[model samples]
Target: MKISEIKEILKGRMLCGEDRMDAVIVAGGAADLMEDVLAAAAKGCVLLTGVTTDHVIRTSKIVGVETIVIVRGKNPPKEFIEMAKSFEIPLMVTEYSLFVACGRLYMNGIRGLDGSW
Candidate 1:
């Protein structure tokens, strides 16, 4: 799926990296724990999380996540947004919970790193 499509599905607002809206997202994962995300997320996956911290941006960089959707209507901090922008990562926010966001992506044919439904 495209990053633009994921934004529409999740009803998210782009926080940065609008130029990357056309980027293809091959897989997705949702997690608040950076460790779990690193362990389970695939490279180039769109990460769905409620944690809006600098660590999230750092983790995304480390784990090769170029797109991130902050769930539960939480807005990311300015520092976090700046970090993501510096890394050229697309950051967005949605009102949906983590589960709902993940379900929407899954139903739209975005699979997990493990290729599970």
Candidate 2:
């Protein structure tokens, strides 16, 4: 699936990287712990998280997450969004909780990076 498809699936709001919405999305991972995400996320993957902080963007940069979906209607700080923009990372806002978001993606054929990374 593509990131744009995810936006449509979740009715999410794109906060940045509008041009990147069509980027290919091969897989996804859900986690609030940046440490875990950094250790396991695949390259070019989408990160689903409830944590909204500057550290999230920093971790994403280090871990190679192309897009971030902030769950539960949470909004990252303005500075963090600006930072993500500067770094060319796409940010999305979804009202669905993390579990529901993950489930929806999975049900729609979005797999995790397990073993395929």
Give the winner by lDDT.
1
lDDT of 1 at 73: 92
Top of the candidates by TM-score: 1
lDDT of 1 by residue, 19-97 (tens): 9999999899888999998898878899998998888889899989969999999877799889999999999999998
List model 2 lDDT by residue over 1-117, tens digit each. Answer: 898999988889999999997799878998889989978898788999998888889999988898999999987789989999999999999999989999999889888978643
Write down the lDDT of every candidate, Cα atoms only: 0.90, 0.90
Error of 1 at 43 (Å): 1.0
C-alpha positional error of residue 100 in candidate 1 after TM-score superposition, expressed in Å = 0.7
Sequence-dependent TM-score of model 1? 0.95
Error of 2 at 9 (Å): 0.9
Which parts of model 2 have CA positions greater than 4 angstroms off? Answer: none
Q: Candidate 1: deviation at residue 64, Å?
A: 0.7
